[model samples]
Target: MKNLRVLDLTSCVDLLVTPKFSGCKNLAILILERCSQLVEVDHSIGDLKCLISLNLKFCTELSMLPVEMGHLTALKELLMDGTKVEEIPISIGQFKQLEGPIATLPDSVGELIRLNHLSVRDCHRIRKLPNSIGNIGISLVELDVSGTGVSKFPNSIKYLQKLKVLRMDSCFFKEFPPDIGELTSLEEIHASWCRSLEGGIPSEIGKLHNLRILRLRHSTISSIPMEIHQLSNLQTLDLLHCDMIKELPRLPSSIRELHVDDELKSSEIWILDNLRLQRLSTSKLPAMIKLSNLQTRRLLHCNTIKEVPKLPSGMMDLRVGDELKSSKIWNLHDLRLELLSTFIIQEEIQLSDPDLVDYFAAP
Candidate 1:
């Protein structure tokens, strides 16, 4: 069919071979996704000069593509996730968007100078990226290698000055690229569930003036770099399940949310003498005598404290168990937080400001 522009045979499990597309000169989209038994794609696919999208997702047994495919100069998007393809063809640099399960990318990938987003998530065989990756750094905005075998980044990653978001969660990398701080335009970094990530964060990370959100949950990191306090634009920091950290450091003044939970038995110490904060959640209450800017606080499973520190006057919400009453840190009868809306405490303790009960009782 010379006029055929779109041909989608998604999930055709019995389709072991693709028919020659030599007659479909106008074909613009070809989708062969989820064809579990598909083993070969006819080389005549190159005859479709107008092809713009090609999807071979989940084609588990398809290990290779014909070199003739390089003739599809109009192709824009290519998806090969969950396929057995081990390497990308050097000609693949012609595409603007690509997602794959391939083991290695051709060095020609650097030729896609305009390519912005690249994802190789769950590609367990890819252990290293080509140094030529820096060739596309000028236009790349985001890169995701999450759930991949990439244990480290090439030194050339520092050349990605325009990169904004990076995600590598659930990876086994032991440390980050030492020059990670060079990505001055970065805004968010999600590295949670990196259980094997050890060796404290590089001090260069403090140089990211544009960084806003940083999450390193469930990691084995033992300490927070003192340089972290330099992140003036930081807003959210999550450290839940990070049992290895022994002491908390002074965080940025712009922080709005902080979640810290250590091991159930470790004597974790917190040195939270902050400038400004809105939300705080942790297992061991820190010495926040200076957290006057705090608005909300939640103490979870905290039964080891001997005394509770002074609560911020601006506190609007507080959630705690019977542990607070058991500690002799402050006089409950003198507590007069007027803005507290939610206070979950033992009925035996009464606050001096009777108005607090009215806010809590409000719908």
Candidate 2:
């Protein structure tokens, strides 16, 4: 067993024992993914001096990791996603080469100077990061803390000079430390659901020229800084449920997907020109005289508009949350209407007109 190099026990639903793999002094990798019933890992696992990797993903019934895991000096990679493990042992920093998602690291985690990848998604109980987290300089490459309860990011994050991706979605941040713009090497960011955030986005954000994806959905932000257009490589901009936003800066031409709610005014509609817009939604249609190149539009909860307008020739899907009179709709193809009320339609007489048959066609 000393020669064991890899152990993969994924989806073994009823597994109940912590593997006694410490006997395999040469073990290099251990993978126990989706072992839902697994309850523990033996503390003696620290005896595997040559171990390089360990993965325990989606082991929901498991409650903790061996505190002695810190003694595995040769371990290089560790991954635990969707598990019930409560807190990361302080001894974790001893590994020197640890990687993957962490819930809450021991204050000693600062000692892991060689860590390169980390994701702490959905760890709702973690309120703050270790103050020493910033001292581990330049080694980390990816960090995602989305869906955690942490309200502020550790200033220590600025030390990760090699970081390529940082995702902090749903963390309830009221504002970010201004120095965040100093992470010049960052390539992507997901900061959705920061409901209390106010003021304009920091102008320094444009300095991350390498950024490719920015998701700020469900935030309270009312306007995007014109500097955002500097992200020449950005591909997706998701601003769903930003109810307070009234206008948008001209989007980057490189953007391929834009998902915004219908709270925008008519003047903002002109921003859609010359881009490959994919999904559009709003409470009311912009009063623009013409729309072309749009592919899909979903209108929700609009009380003012009485009819649909002449849409682009390539428009494929149109979903209306409320029914409109047949005559108010000028030309509709591939329409999907929901929650129609006869009383509402009768009040808007255009729908009952006999000539309406030429314009409305269901798909």
Candidate 3:
């Protein structure tokens, strides 16, 4: 037992208590997933100095972890989701990764000052975060609360100055902290599927000079703050399925990917001057004069556009609906470029040239 390195007891529903691991000093991985009857873990589990991964997911009866867990200095990943565990031992602060569906996190969790990543995804019971989380300081690089019931962020979140990635997708939050701008190191924020989010994005987001990607897909936001144009380093912006957005604000020239819906067909979008755009999926086909660098274009559901604008020479993919395919200006040979990969047209639009069809059919 002392030499055992991996132990997987997954789906052991009858397991009531974990065996003492004092004799398995070299055990590096222990999985007790789906042990619905498990009520306690042996304190001797702390004796496995070489243990690196411990998974106790779906242990419905487990409510507490042995305090000696802090002794596992080499532990790196600990997953306890689907368990009844509510209060984690302060010893958990020694771990770098902690994920679960616990109701609340103990303030002692802040002791993990060196933790770089923390995820509580799908923890529907969690409504708020512990204020002590702010004490994690610059070491926290990414924080994910997606699929949780959390409706608000603790004001202390402003202290995560070094956080770079934040994923709150599918959460219940309606607004972001006004001090979100204080997170100067943030690079990506994915709040997609947050249908409850309204009141528009905080203009303070302009303070995120290093932000690279911002997605608010399926939200109820009626307008984007003009301050978003200040994100000079932003490269990707996705607002697809946001039917409430009536107009788009001027975007930065650095943007490479932009996705929007047909609701803005009549809205004036001044993106013709952005030369660096690489991918554009929109219902409005703007004039393409300075778009030599564009690679992909999806002009679907654009029944209002009468004529097809001159396309960029570097386009690699073009997908259009029946309206644009049947236009008098639609010519396959003129668009048959060297870089074109996928040219998707509606089935109703018949192909006149058999050679063009065969070229696309070539594997």
Candidate 4:
């Protein structure tokens, strides 16, 4: 099999140990996707110096990669999502074309000057990234480290001048590094669930001229810099559960989707002017209903909202909390009511509504 060029061993349910594929010296692509029972890749894999692509997606039972895997110098692409692999060997930095989701690369990973497109999603155990990662400079393209336990980004990240997309969702960073503005080529960023983040967002964030999407959900952010309005290319902004955020600056005219929490006060609602804005969530409906652009609005767990606000004639879908008084629902053209739990509706409402009979019937 030394001359074999492609080998796909995907979804082999009983496959436990890694197969001896190193004999395929000329192998260009090897895929082992959804092999849930796989435990480890054999060290002999290093002998496949001609391998270009390797995929190990959804191998939930996998624990680690072979330490000698770094010797596959000809490898170009690698994908390992939903695996238990804990540590990436430092020797991996020697691979000039390695790409894809890796939680923690070896400190020497900067040596892969030709590497591009790294995605490290749901790696909850990682605490930090290699400091030398910045050395890759303009060669790197996309970096996605969402759902990791990282608290801080390596300062070297600013050196990736060619980075286009950065997704750092659920990172526990208390604050973003000031140097983040240096990634001039960045186009999108997802930094949701950074609960401890404090201070206002850097005004310089608007400097990324190509930025299109910014997601900062479940963060402790108290205020957004007025400079945020400068992101002319911005299309979607998701700010769910930013409990301390007191107000919003005028949104960029290009924004189309805005998802916010239910607790925003009346004053904070004035800044929204997205003519195409479609999604909204709040504790109470506003007193002055003028949602000509609204398509979907969900009011969650707000007990005090006794009456639904007047919606625009164009409004299509409306979801209201269960606490509101029951009525023959004829007024709302496309209204959908989702009743809340007795505990969530309000502390005062003790009498359980018979419509809630479904809640107690759930398995």
Top model number, lDDT: 3
CA displacement after TM-score superposition, residue 47 of candidate 2 (Å): 2.0
The residue-by-residue lDDT of candidate 1 on 79-101, one tens digit each, is: 89888888877777676766787
What's the TM-score of each model vs. the native? Answer: 0.81, 0.67, 0.80, 0.68
Q: Rate the local accuracy (lDDT) of all candidates.
A: 0.76, 0.69, 0.78, 0.70
Off by over 4 Å in 2: 7-22, 31-40, 55-64, 74-85, 94-103, 272-363
Instruction: Put down candidate 2 lDDT per residue, 278-319, tens digits, no spaces.
Output: 444333455562456565554534444555665554555554
Q: Which stretches of candidate 4 lie over 4 Å from their true place?
A: 8-22, 31-43, 55-67, 74-85, 94-103, 272-274, 278-363
* Model 2: pairs clashing at backbone N, Cα or C within 3 Å: 134-156, 262-282, 262-283, 326-351
* Candidate order (TM-score): 1, 3, 4, 2
Off by over 4 Å in 3: 284-307, 310-363
Clashes of each: 0, 4, 0, 4
> Scored by Cα lDDT, where does model 2 land?
0.69
**TM-score attained by model 4:** 0.68
Candidate 4 colliding pairs? 101-119, 262-282, 262-283, 322-339
Alpha carbon lDDT of residue 255, candidate 1? Answer: 77
Better of 3 and 4 by lDDT: 3
TM-score of candidate 2 relative to the true fold: 0.67
Error of 1 at 220 (Å): 2.4
